[model samples]
Structure formats: C-alpha cells, structure tokens
Target: MSQWQQPGDRRTRGRVLRWNLAGWILFGLLPQAVAVLDASPARRYWLLGLLVLIALCHTVVVNRPDNPLLRHGTYLHLLALVLGSTAYLMDGGAAFYVVSLPQFWLFTRAPRDAITLSGAAAALTVFGGTLHQGWSPQFLTGNVISTVVACVAGAGLGLWVHHFVVRSNERQEQLTAALALTQKELAAAYQQQGAAQERERLAREIHDTLAQGFASIVVLAEAARAAAVNDPVRCAEQLTSIEQTARENLAEARVLVGSAPESGVAAGSLAITLRRTLDRFAQDTGLTVTAELPDVDLDQRTRVALLRCTQESLANVRKHSGASTVGVVLTELAGGVELEITDDGCGFVVEDSRGYGLDGMRRRLAELDGELSVISSLGDGTRVLASLPTHSQDRA
Candidate 1:
C-alpha cells in the first residue's frame, strides 16, 4: 500500500513562493525604472543595490518561513526604501515612494514579530530623515507626509495580508481532511474483503463435515427401518449400528463449530494439522486416513478449515460406509490445493440426494473460488473431490 502524506504541504509551499515571486518582481521593476530615469552614477549604484537586495528577499522568503529572517528582511526593505528616497531627494525629485515591505506581516509565520520590527524600521527612517534634512520647513512637510503615508499603508495592507493568508490556510486544511477520508475508505474496503473470505471458508467446513454426516444418518436410519419390517433380531442389530453412526455425526457437528477434539499440535497448515486430527479420529473409530506425500505451505486458518472438512468426511464414512477400508488423498499443485476422500463402501446415488453436507461443501468452495464434485454408485466405491484456488486462500 502507498504510504499516507499531508496533501496540503505542497500546495502551501508552492502558493507562498508564487506570492513572494510577484512581490520580488515588482521590487525589481521599480529599481530598474529609477536607474533609467534622470540618472547619476551615485543614484544608479543605490538602485542597483536595491535590485540585488530585493532579489535576495525572494530567496529568503521562498526558503524560510521563520520569524528572524522575516524581521531582518523587513528591516532591509525599509532601509533600501530610505536610501532610494534620499537618492531621489538629492536629485530634486518631486516625489518619493517606499515599496512598503510590511505587507509581509499578514502572510508570514510570525506576524506579530513582523509588525513590531516593521514599526521600529519606520521609526528609524523618519528619525534619520528629520535630523539629516536639517529641520527646514520642506523637511518638516516631507516628514509629516512620510509618517502619515507609512502608517496608513502598513495598517491597511497588514490587515489585507492577514485575511488572504487565512484563506490560503483554510484551503490547506480542507486538502488534508480530504486525504484522511480517502485513506479511511481504502482501509474499510480491505476489511470487508477479508470478512467475506472468512465467511466462505466456514460454509465449506459445514459442507465437508456436517453435510456428509447427516447423509450417513439418513442412510443408516433407512436401512434399520427396512430390516425391522422383515426380521426383529436383525432390526435390533441395525439400531445398535445406527446409534454409533449418530454419535459420530454429533462429534462431526461439534468440530464443525470449532470444538475439535483436543489433539495437541504446535502449528502449521490445515493439511498438516488434519493429519494429527485424523490420527485421533482413527483411534476413536478404527478408520484410517491415507495420503501420498506432497508439499504445500498452508496458513493456520486454512489448516483449521481443511481439518474440519477432513473431520466431517471421516465421521460420515465410519457411520454409513459398510467397508473394511477408507482412503484420503491430498495433492498440492503450483497454484492450488486439492483433497479427495474415497471409500470402498455401499455407495449411494449422489444425484438423488440434495444433502446439507453437500450444500455446505459447495458454498465453502465458492468462497475459495473452488469446486466440489462427487462420483459414486449403489455398489461401487465413493469418491469426493474438492479443489481450491491458491489466490483465494487467506494467509491470515
């Protein structure tokens, strides 16, 4: 799965850099205009320095959002403004302008510090201009206008910058929320898929174990009834046989519900664990489960499901298959698992009976993307075959 990340991080960084780029572009333009108009080398040199300084501000704002740089950058901008204004005054220019770097107060991380530092900057500029301009009437007039204009622009522009950044921050937050919801939805989908697979496995267990058992019970009861009408002594013997058959079915049902007979096993696949279960099963009923050698890696959950299927098959054979031998064949393939249960017993027509045991097996196989087939006759042996797809197997 792809790892999760904050969606807003990229948007915030890109948007902030773009905004500062526009500011630096305007800063660059104004100095080049000063260098072009009514030029002297001393003033041109001052404008060239302003151009370089503004370019540096772009780099600083683009790379850093910390308070100190914002403070220092703001101070540099104000000092550059004062130098530009002084250059214009010396050339007897009619008007002077500062780019008003205090607009940064609203967008930067440390706005209050930007504001405090900007105020100090404006004070130093006004103080220096007043003392150096020699207290003349023209100096007094320029001082008043400069103070009023700087205060008005800083107050109004600071509020506007704050409002714009707040909007950007809100957009960032929304992006983050959307990403979180997407991740949660993906997690829920995986959980549902796991649940569906587990349900299918349980259904198969019911078919292989419980369905087959019920079928035997039906056959045993029918046999006893038919014999009872002809011979009373034989009827008593059949009843005794049916009792054992019913007891085996009850055991199969218990194991189907996960109450397997406590045969101690450290752990492994369903096939491996079932060998141990079948050993105990053989001890209880004197029926053997035989398998040819094969290798497969089965997860624990699959081991239990397969064991239940084996348990149910063995129970049915012990109760109803009037045979001296029982055989179990397990095969492993490159991409799947297969199990075959065979018996040389009084087989019955599979097509004639829609037993619960068969139905359960069919459902379980469906879950595993597998299939079950039964081949048998009234006189010959019975063969039960089931195959499961590898991809459908749950590793859990």
Candidate 2:
C-alpha cells in the first residue's frame, strides 16, 4: 500500500506468505492431526473443527492486516485456542502451542504487540499443561521451558527483522526523492539550453540578412540625396536601388518572423546569386569588382553559408577597406567547394579583429562542418576563404 512498495516487494511478500503457510501445515496441522489419530471420535472431530476455525481466522488476519478489529481479535482468539487445546488434549495438544508461536509475530504490526501476545500464548500454554499434569517435572522440562524459550527468541528475532525492514524502507524513500529531484533539474537545464541556442540562431539570422540590408539602405539613401539635382538620372537609379533593398529587407523580416517559409536566398545557380550580389555592391560603392563563379552543385545549407560569408565579407570591404578593386572567386576542389573574396583595401590584422559579423560567418560555416579563414595584415589586402565538404552536395 505504501508508495515505496515496488513490484519486486509485492512478489517477496507473496513468497513469505507461502513459506509461512507451509510452516503451519508441516509443523502445526500435520503433527496434531497425526497425534489425535487414536483419540475418541467426538474429541477428534471437535479438535479438527477448532483447527479449521483457527485457519479461517488466520486467513482473515492475513488478508486484512491493516484492519485493527480483525487483527487484534484474531490474536486473542488464537491465544484462547492455544489454551483450550493444551488443556483439552494435554500432551497431545502441546505441539499446537509451540507451532502457533510464530502467528503472534505474523498477525501483529508492532514489535510490542507481537511480544505481548506471544508471551501471553506461552503463559497460557504452560498453565494448560500444568492444570492437567499437576506441575510434573517431565511436563515442565519438555513443554514449559521450551515454550518460554521460544517466546523470548521469537520476540527478539521479530524485533530485529522489524528494525531491518523499517530502515530499508526509509532508505528507499530517500533515494526515490533524490531521483525525482534530479530528473526535474535535468529537464529544466535542457529547456534553458534550448532557449539559449535559439537566441543565438535568431541573432545570427538578423545579422546575416536584415542587418546587412538596413546598412545597404543607409548607403543608397545618402548617395541618392547627394546626386539629387546635378545627377537626376543617377539619383533616380539610387532611389530604385533603395526601393528594391527595402522590399528585400521586408522579405527577410517575414522569414525571420515565421510568416515566410523559405529563406531570403532564392533557389538558383549559386554563381548567378553571387553575381547579382556583386553587381549590387558595385552599383552602390562604385568599386571595381571582378568575379569567376562557375556553376557548382551544393545543398541548401552549404549554399546559404557561402552566400552569408560573401555578404559579410563584402560588407567589411565596403565599410573598412578603402580599396579600389575587389575580386570574388568560386572554385570546386577534389574533396569540396570553396569561395574566396579578396580586396586590395587597407586590411586590418585578422587576429586583432573581434567582430560579430566574422564570428557569425564562422558559426554558419561550422554548422555545415565547413570552415572560414581570413587572411590580412595592416598594409596588405584581405582574403576571406570559405570551404564546405562535398558530402552534403545536391547533385540534382
């Protein structure tokens, strides 16, 4: 009935009940039944009826050990049976008292109750024998002394077993509590870790798409304002570029917010995608740009990573690199594919740079088991190389 009781404990309790029943049959019922074989018919029948009544009481006690009335009443009834049987059968009934000793412990819940009832049974057993035999030395030595000794030993053994079971149950409850606490903490930790990773992903997505588009919008707005009067044609082109950039930023926003199912990158040749991006960069910055991008098969993940790396690299070149020439190259290697973007701009030390754009690019590539490398120095140019393995390539 206790929560600590497992299936195994139920099985063990069943086994103990079977063994106890076996003990009763072998020592209590069989010996007494055999001893009364030569007795008169009425005495034999009455004794057998009493035995059946005792067995029924035992069954009721065992079935409902938690019921206070049944448990207590059965112990008292069994004690009366022991006394009556001892007096009625005299020497023949002595075995019944001895065999019934264990029932006191079996039927009672507490050690005090078991010890008290067993002591009473022992006393009743000795008194019944003394009443019939007149305190004979043979009866005292054979029955009285043995009953007293058994009562003391059974009480001690029952107390020890009761102590052991209580301690074991307490320990099991403690372990169950600890395991529940651990599982709760583990689930909370997993939720926190998932939330943190999701935050990082959103940050990367904004930086690669929305943030870059906004930056381009600012540049185009400034150019359109400057060429407004003198260069109306150039200003109109800048305005068109601005409108296109705003629409693209809107699309990227929709994707980030879950309204759009697809990414900002269109499904097409990777070379054409890079070329269109380059043409936009040239139009905005008026910088000389040359690129050699061949058609290469790549999975969506690899394609997105490389495109982000190119965009981030070009953004750096425009903002930081005050150079006149930039070149982009996409090549297929024996084991993988690679993208290289170079600028003749005044490059900064790669090791000293700790920009989030660069870190985002590296993370994006790393997700595909790819790598990003930036080569630069104070006076020299910067070269950004992004490489991805061919295993995830889409042949179709």
Candidate 3:
C-alpha cells in the first residue's frame, strides 16, 4: 500500500510541475522562436539580440509583483517584442506581425497587466507593419482596423481568464479554512461524547454496588432505632452492621473511581471520601457526625446520587447552618432509594436561600428522575429529603 501511494503522489507532483513548465515555456520561449522564424539575416541579429535580452530579463532574476524590478521585466519583455516585430517589418510586406507573443506574458506572470501590454504590443505591431507594407491610406486603414479588432478581442479574453483565476484562488482558500474548522468541531464533538460515556459508566457502577450497600445501612439503622428500647446490645450490633455496610460500599466506590487498591487513595469512595469529609466537618465546626447505612442491592446511579447529595447537603450545613449535630440517613423505600440529611442548626428560610447547594441538588436529582424536599426556617433545624426514581420513572 505504501508503494502504491508513493507512486500516486509522485505522479500528481509530476503533473503539476509539467503544467507550470508548459505555461512558462509557452510565454517565455515562444517569442524567441517567432523572432527566429520571421527575421531575415540582416534583421536576425537585432531580433535575436532582443529575444536574448527578454530571456535574460525573465531567467536569472525573480519577478516580484510589487517590486520595481517587475516593471523592468515587463519593459524588457515588451521592448524585445517591439524590436523583434520591427526586424520582421523591415523585411518585405510583413503585415501580420504584432505584439501577439508579448501578450502571452500576461497569463504566465501578472494576469492583471495582460490587457494593457497585449493592446500596446498589438498597436505597435500594426504601426510597424503598416509602415513597412507601404503607408497607403487603403492598406494602412484596413490593417489598423484589423489590429484594433484583434487587440480589443484578445484583451477582453485575457481579462476574463484573470478574473477566473483570482476567483478560483479565493474559493480554494475559503474551502480550506472551512475544512479546518470542520475538523476542529468534529474533534470537540468526539471529546464531549467520550465524557458523556464516562459519566454513564460511573452511574452504572454506583447503581450496581454502593446503592445496595446504602439500602442495607438504612435498614440496619432503622432496626437499631426499633431495638434501642428493647435491647441496647442489639442496637450496638445494628450500628456495627451499618458501619460494615458503609465500609463495604465505600470499597466498591473506590474500585469504580479507578483508584489503585494498594496506595489506599480510594479516589473519593465511601471509605476514604465519606470518612474524611465527615471528620473534617466535625473537626472544623463543633458539629457531631451521625450516619445510618444498611446493606442492600444498590444501582450505581443511585449510589452516586445519594453520595453526592449527602456531600453537598452536609457542606451546606457546615457553612450555612450553625448546627451541633448533622444526621445522615440512607434508606430503601418501598421500591426506590431515599437519603435524608437533618442538621440541628440555625437554618434559614428555603425560599430565600442564596446558596447553590439546593439548586445543585435539584439539578442532580433531575437527571436521575428523583425528587428533593427541603424543610427549614430561621433558628430551626434544616432537613433535606431526596427520593430516587423507580425503575419505571421516565428517563428521557
């Protein structure tokens, strides 16, 4: 395949070089040939000299469109044409000689100047030709008319070609710019899609592991509440059970987050993340941390939702509510998951909240088709309740 591609590339390069070379040769060398063919021995030296001068002007020096040197090049080319035409005219009855050869320069060099150069050369050719052919009114008049006709027609044609080339170049530039922009947009779109896929994967992991563990914690916490009066020892057992549920769920979360097990970073799992967050909150503000979790099957999405919601609510409690004890609850409802965070803090009115905590909670819940409820008042405790959607909930 590489060999085939190499040959194809070389062929294309060869074709482009050939086209450029053909254009240069037709414009530069053709005039020399005309001078050689038309001039006799007496005029040949002058004609050949002029042709050589044109070749020299165009050959060794590079022609810059804006530099004064271009004017010199144009002058050299036209002077050569005029001198060559004069040589032809000095011969007998040379009527057809005109600036025809010089006009070819317009296509090869600056197309914009083609009309003026070709017209001037044609006019001079007619002048030289008419004088040489015998300046009788009838012949001179006819030749001048023909020369004018040819010059006008050729100038119009050259201008059309110049406009076409300029437009083609402009269009090619636009298409190249558009293609680059399109590739950039396509790359951005692919990155966005990859991010979305990662988010979905995280959600699925949370639903599979942490959600179930939180549900089990809620059951055990509630059991502890019920058994507290009957048997304090069993209540202690239930607390132990909830603690175990939390630890196991956290381990699962760590795996989902891609943290290596050996280093023990846990990458924000329940074991590492929740404990650190709770410890910091308790240490910073004199509020005690209370957690109740149970063992159960939890979906990856449900676990993520519950954990994030809990983290946000507790942070808000620490920052906004001057609470003594913040309660964290994870429970399984009849057919869905539930998380409740209650802080015995100086709460503000929910309607007048200037914080992003509730708003962000609402947004996150909306994605899971969940519902959020907040109850709080000035000087009263704040309570946050989140109810996850059932499997039947509309995801779209």
Candidate 4:
C-alpha cells in the first residue's frame, strides 16, 4: 500500500504560499497605492476601493492555506483572475496583480487548467493595457508578444515544480509504509520465538523428569516380577524403590503443570539425559541401539533442540521405520554441534509423505537457528541429521 504523505511537506507548501501573498502585498499593492495619488479625486476613491477589494480576495483564500476547496477545484484561481483583471483595467499599475494569477493556478492545479487560466489573464492584461494607454500598433504588438512569453514561461516552471513535489511525496510515503511493515514482522517473529522457547523448555523438563522416571518404574517392575517367587526379599526392595520413584515423579509432574521452576534430569549434564533416553528406547522398542555422544556443556536452547531431535528421530524409527537397529552419533564442529540418527528400516519416499511429527521437529530446530535433514528411500534406510549453532542462542 502507498504510505500517507507527511504533514511536514504540506506545511512547507503552506509557508511558501504565505510568502507569495506577502510579496503581493508589499510589491504589488504599493505600486497601485502610488498610482492612486495621480488620479482625479472622484476616480481616486473608486480605484482605492477596487484595490482594497482585490487585496481582500487574495487574503481570504490564501489565509485558508492547505484547504481542499482550492486544491480539488479552480474556484480560487477564477476569483483571482476576475479580481486581478478588474483592478488592472481600473489602475494600470495594479497590473502587478497579474503575476499572482499564474502562480495560484499552476501551483496545485492541473497543467491544462493552469495554462488555460494563465492564457486568459495574459489576453486580459494586453486588452486592459491598450484601453488604458490608448490603442497603437506598436503597443499592441509589444504587449501581445511580452504577455504570452511571460505567462507561458511562468506557467511551465510552476507545472514542473508541482510535478517534482508530487513525486517526492509519493516516494516518501512508500518508504514510510515499507518501514512500518518491517517493524511489524519483526515484532511477530519475536513473539513466535518466545512461544517456541517456552515449549522447548517444557519438553526438555518432561523428557528429563517424568518420562525418565516412568521408564525407571517400568524397568523396576519387570525386575520385581522376575524375582517375586525366587527372591521375595529382593522383590520387596524393588517394590519400595518403585514406590519412591512414583512419589518423586508425582511431585515433578506437579511442578511441570504449575508455574514453578522445573526440577529434572536437566540439573545434570545433557549426556546423562541422552544415555537415559537411549536406554529407554532400546528397552521399549526392542531395537538394538548404539550411540556416540559428546560430553559437553551447551546453553539451554541448544540442549533442548538437540534432545528433541533425538527423541523425534527415535520415535519415528520405533513407530514407522520397522528397523531392527539404530545409531545415534553427536559431535562438536568448529562453531556448532551436529547429531545424526540412522536406522535400517522400511523407509518411505521423502516426497510422498510428511506428518506433523517431522514438521514439528524441523520447526523446533529452526527456532534455534538449527536445521533438520531426513534422507530415506524405499527398502533402504532413514537417517535424520540435525545441526545447531552453539554460540548464538535465542534467549526469547
């Protein structure tokens, strides 16, 4: 959309018009004031009245600077033309008012409008000068030539100025609109970043605390059942440990649901959490899993991004890859970190299918200025690779 014009340009134009009117009062009317002293007493009074009336006409319209009445139509120019021509015929010196005629019509009016009105005024000036000074061939020839030249040149210059102002204002408006749109987009992006960060924080907390706690409970129960008849005392100890784990998990779940600081596996290093995730995946899916993870400290956002990518990749393999084995490898690069998940499975064509799971993983990584790539083919295998920058983390 085109931007709106600024008030500063309008005010600048208004100031120029005011100065033009001031010039007419000081230079234009003073000449007529001097000419009136040379007239007969009876004609002098009428000439003075006409001059005052003409000045009043200019004053009335120019005082209402920036008014749409004069901008959208030619009423103000027509008034100037009539009053100026009448004053010129009454007092030859009052012809100075003729200069304002072209200026008013050309400043904002259309080119054809300024040209037509200026031409009429030029004709009237020559006619009035002839009748006032008495007709002569030399006078008529000189007046016509000079009047047309002055009026045409003045009107042409005024039209050019008007065109320049219109173009400059239009460009300024467009720039202003584009700047506003950019600011809005930036604000929306910041908001989205804030929401995504909150989501990742919660997800990391759940994976570290509740999900890990549940996995331990399942393993303990399985151990307890195996020893129930053979070793009753050992099974009793296992039950007690399960009860304690469940109670701790319940408290962690409460903290997760409420507006409280998260308490979970996040307190330790990321490698510990990944180890637990690897173990749980192997225990649940019965898929032989191997991992080569780095021991490094990462900012909160990067840690969350990496953990989520791992969780999503393994989940996909367990549910869809139909793979018997999976491998997870994480390493640090020159300025960033990379994780790769590979599985021998019944993979599908990347172009044919996509679900929210994959899209969500990409989105989560993107929020951290990271990327996720999945390569797969039918009867082949699937590999998910995620890369995240370590230095510039998004706090929002």
Alpha-carbon RMSD, each predicted model: 10.1, 3.9, 12.9, 8.9
Over 4 Å off, model 1: 1-63, 69-87, 90-172, 185-310, 319-339, 343-370, 376-382, 388-396
How many clashes does each candidate structure show, in the order listed?
Answer: 6, 0, 21, 0
- With candidate 3 superimposed using the best TM-score fit, by how many Å does residue 193's alpha carbon deviate from the native? 4.0
**TM-scores across all candidates?**
0.45, 0.81, 0.46, 0.53
**Could you give the candidate ranking by TM-score, starting with the highest?**
2, 4, 3, 1
**Over the stretch 216-289, how does candidate 2's per-residue lDDT look in tens digits?**
99998998999998999999999999998899889889988899876755676788889989999999889999
What's the TM for model 3? 0.46
Error of 1 at 321 (Å): 5.7
RMSD of 4: 8.9
Give me candidate 1's TM-score against the actual structure: 0.45
Cα deviation in Å at residue 322, candidate 4? 30
lDDT, residue 213, candidate 1: 51
Query: Largest lDDT belongs to which candidate?
Result: 2
Clashing residue pairs in candidate 2 are none
